[model samples]
Target chain A: MKKTVYRIYTSIIFLFLYAPIGTLMVLSFNSSKTRAKWGGFTLKWYSELFQNDAIMKALWNTLAIAFLSAVFASIIGTIACIAMTGMKKKWRSVLLGITNIPMLNADIVTGISLMLLFLTFGFKFGFLTILLSHITFNIPFVILSVMPRMQGLNPSTYEAALDLGAGPVQAFFKVVFPDILPGVLTGFLMAFTMSLDDFIITHFTKGAGVDTLSTKIYTEVKKGIKPEMYALSTLIFIAVILLLLLANSRSKIKSVKTAERGKS
Target chain B: MNKKMLSLPYLFWSIAFILIPLGMIFFYGFTDKTGAFTLENILAISQAEHMKALWLSILLSLISTIICLALAYPLGLILTSMEVNQNGFIIVLFILPMWMNFLLRTLAWQTLLEKTGVINGILSFLHLPSLNIINTPYAIVLGMVYNFLPFMVLPIYNSLAKIDRNVINAAKDLGAGNLYILKRIILPLSFPGIVSGITMVFVPALTTFVISTLLGGSKILLIGNVIEQEFTQASNWYLGSGLSIVLMVFIIINMVLSAIFDKDGEGGLL
Candidate 1:
């Protein structure tokens, strides 16, 4: 009885969570422009989503910004983590505290602050500003992810590489880099997702004619959201699901192999 | 030793982007258009419109945070009690909805709750009372709870999962009943998670303009909406920055509380 109750409760929560998403997926195939009644199912929206140039552009911008910001943030964040590992304890904590500012502060404040900075400097609120703002926010996420792995690095192996006559750069890369690769990958993925999901920050930082899918959706809110957007969102959702599944399976296989190796 | 120099780029970046930008908010917030330092902008929060918006934002966010806590704590408990393999998959399932666009998700609720919406359609078909809460504070609260529930759940679940089973077993052996154990051990142990979850939910819900704008309609104003309008529509950066500073005070209090409770940073998403 207890187990059944737990199962029922879980099912209700899951339904509540997915109801919106399921509605969106259903609406993508909706033939009627209006959401009130379901018209007969049609695939026209999917085709129309592809044909819509402005939306396609926004989609492209979203992907490009997510990718670029993640890559840049990963580089800077990993380097920061390495530097932090060598720092005095007080200074390291201080830097980490600063890093948390973007993470802990409300998005509106961060967005507004960056907007003030851009305007103060007489900079245009365009792709560059948006990218810069994203990179700033993304860096902390990357650092948070990578810093733990940095702390776990065994110094002996690195010193052993040095004793073996490897150059400092070579020794660090071959010994330390591989050890922290997983953390770095995790950080990069986190940053990418954050950039892709950002709407408020992008809304403030983005200029006229520069629309991420998020900003595009926001603008369309006052006007009715287009059916093509529903189709686009459904596709994006499916893609994320597939990617997560692939990541999950790969991790499962790796864990299984590690278990087997441990038994041996 | 030379590796310490590697932090230069990040140090420069943070100073230029993070610290300097924040400083700009203070600067703008404290100054007038001619750059004269004055407290008028900051004092503007006491004005009728601004104070009402602030109070409403606080009241609604508090309600949403409480609702999220109530809903998520049980779910977290259930999740932690499950098998390890099942736990990971279930947590992932909960987080999956977050991967979708939040705007689109909120927009979905707008469709469902609108008078001519699906929920009402279903209600009328069943001869049940239609939901008239759309475009009200109740709808906004629903949207907040829906959007931020995962943030509350994840942290609580993480902290709950970390509790040692042996400790619970020891408590059971010590003649503690289920209610006593829950109240004494489980609740106290999960305090950090609860604090972190509250901060996470409360901060966003308080600062959210989009959720309120979509669900609350234009008639109801939030502090976030006021600030957003100042920056975007009104083009009054000084007033916007001032209101943001007021909002930041609440956010800072939340951060300080989370920092005090979650010292180990165990409540983080990772």
Candidate 2:
């Protein structure tokens, strides 16, 4: 009886979470201008999404920003993690707390604060400022993802490589890099998703004439309701789902490989 | 020389980008245009009505956080108990609305809750009175809960999934009822997630001007709107900085109070 009730309850909760997105996706394909009624199914919205230059441009811009921010954040976040690992424990914890303030800080506060700094410094809102800010927020996630793996890593491999006449750089490149590559990749993927998904900070930092998909969506929503916006949202939702699947599969493969390694 | 060379880039990044900007925010909070620091301007700006706004923002945030927790606790438990199939689907459902641009989501809610929108249409179709949820405190809460539900759910889900089933089974085998088991066992174990989720929800809800601006339609004035006005319209950096500081302090105080107040039965670390 309990099991039956549990199953029913769980199904309702899942449906509650998913039903809205499913409705949105279905409405995107609906030929009706209004979302209230399902008129007829057509591939017209997807075609409309493709032919829209502004949407295409925004998609490209979003991808470019996500890519640039992810790469930079991974490199910087990984180095920061490595640097933190060598620090005194008490000092390290303090630094960790300090670095994590951005994560905990309210988005409006952070966005406004960064906006103020940009104005004060006379820094133009463009690719570089947005990238830097993205890295700032993305770094915490990468740090969180990579730090645990770094802690679990056995340091003896690097020591063994050094004792075998390998220079520190050579030892790091050949030994340490391969072992931590999965964690670093996971961090990179996380940063990419975060940068792609960012709205509030991007809205504040994006100057005139520069727009990501998020900013574009915001503008569209304000200017007028458009069915193309739903189409674009559906596309983004699908892309995120695909990437998440790829990440999950890759992590599963890594887990199996690690299990095999342990057995051997 | 080698170590310094290696550390130079990081030092420059942290100092120039992070530390100095933070210092500027602090300095600008105090100083005037001539760069002389004074509390006069800040003090003059903090009137009784501004105090009311501060309290209102805090109260609304507290309420919204509670609602999000009430919704999320059951939902999080359900997510954790289910078999993992299409987790990507589940995550996307949870995260896409959050990712889709906050303004757009707020606008969608506005559309959905509009007098002519789906909710009213459905109500009227069912021979019920069309309710006016927009431009109310309830609307503000609803918008906030919709936006921040995922934040609350994710942390609690993470915690619930991490709980050992054997412990739950042991409690059940000892003839503990579901309610007692949840109250004594599950809730205690998930306190960390609850703490994290509450913090996440409260902080954002406190400063969410967009929701209030769009849905509440000037009915509710949050601290965020006031800060926005100070920076953009009023051009009073000193007052804005002072307000920012006050808001931050208020948020921290609320956090501490809630932490103490909420963790009654559970052994939670302050």
Candidate 3:
């Protein structure tokens, strides 16, 4: 009886969670533009999604920004983490505190502040400004993810590489890089997702004619949303599901291997 | 190698992008359009319309945060009690919606709650009462809770899953009942997660303009809407910056509380 109740409760919550998503997916295929009644199912929206140039441009911008920001944030964040590992405790904490500012502050404040900064400096609010703002926010996520691995790093192995006559860069690549690879990968993925999901910050920072998928969606809100957007979101959702499943299975295999090694 | 030199780029970036930008907000908040010092912008919060918006934002966000907590705590407990592999699968399911565009997700609710929407259509078919809460504060609250529930769940679930089973077993062996153990051990142990979850949900809900705009309609005004209008429509950067600084005070208070409670930062996003 208790188990039954628990299952029922969980199912209800899951229903609440997935209902909107399921509704959107269904609407994506509806032939009618209105939500009041379901029209016969059709694949026209999917084809139309591809043919829409503005949406295609927005999609391209979204992916490009997410990718570039993640890459840049990963490099800068990893370097900062390494530097932090060697810093005095007080200074390291101070840096970490500063890093948390973007993460902890409300997105609106961050958005407006950056907007004010760009306007003050007379920097054009275009793709570059959006990219810069994303990189700024993305860096902290990368650092937070990498910092734990940095803390766990074996200094002896790095010192041994140095003693073996390897140059500093060579020693780092040989010893420290492999050890922190998981953290770096995780950071990069996190940053990518964050950039992709961001809307408010992009809305404030983006200029005229520069539309990410998010800003594009916002513009369409006052006007009725196009059916093409629903189709695009459906594709994006399917893609995310596949990617996460792949990542999940790979992690599962890795854990199984670790367990086997432990037994050995 | 001067290891410190490696951080110089990041240091410069933060100063330029983070610190200076924040300083500009303060500068704008306290200055007039001509750049003369004035407190009028800051004092604008006391005006009737602004005050109403601020209070509405606070009230609605508080309710959403509470509702999120009520829903998530049990969900977290359930997730933690599940087998490890099952736990992972379920969490993935919870996080899946977040991967979709947030605006679209909220917009989906807009469709469902409209008078001729899915829910109402179903209800009328069944001869049940239709939900007419769309374009009201209630709809806005629903949107907030829907969007932020995952943020609340993930942290609480992480903290709860980390609790040592042996400690619970020990408590059981003592004279404590299940309720006693939950109240004393589980609740206190999950305080950090609870604090972080509250902070995460509350701040966004309080500052959200999009959710309110889509669900609350133009009829309801939020502080976020006021600030956004000032920046985008009204082009009153000084007034916008001033209102933002006021909003930042609430955010800072929440952050300080979270920092006090979650010292280990264990409740951070995974």
User: Largest DockQ belongs to which candidate?
Assistant: 1
Expressed as tens digits, the lDDT of each residue in B231-254 for candidate 3 is 999999999999999999999888
lDDT (tens digit, per residue) of candidate 1 on A39-143 = 999999999898999999999999999999999999999999989988999999999999999999999999999999999999988899999999999999999
Per-prediction TM-score to the true structure, in the order listed: 0.96, 0.87, 0.96
DockQ of each: 0.80, 0.36, 0.78
> Model 3 off-target regions past 4 Å?
A253-264, B84-87, B261-270
Each model's fraction of native contacts: 0.82, 0.21, 0.77
Chain A (candidate 3) TM-score to true chain A: 0.96
Question: At residue A188, what lDDT does model 2 achieve?
Answer: 93
Instruction: State each candidate's clash count.
Output: 0, 0, 0
Q: What local distance difference test score does each model get?
A: 0.92, 0.76, 0.92
Error of 3 at B23 (Å): 0.3
- lDDT at B17 for candidate 2? 58
Residue-level lDDT tens digits of model 2 in A109-164:
67667777888889998777777778777877788888888898898988899999
In candidate 3, position B106 carries an lDDT of: 95
Docking class of 2: acceptable
- The TM-score of candidate 1 is 0.96
Model 2 agreement with the true structure over B104-211: per-residue lDDT tens digits: 556666656778876788799999999899888888888788778888988888888878999999999999999998888888888878888988898889987777
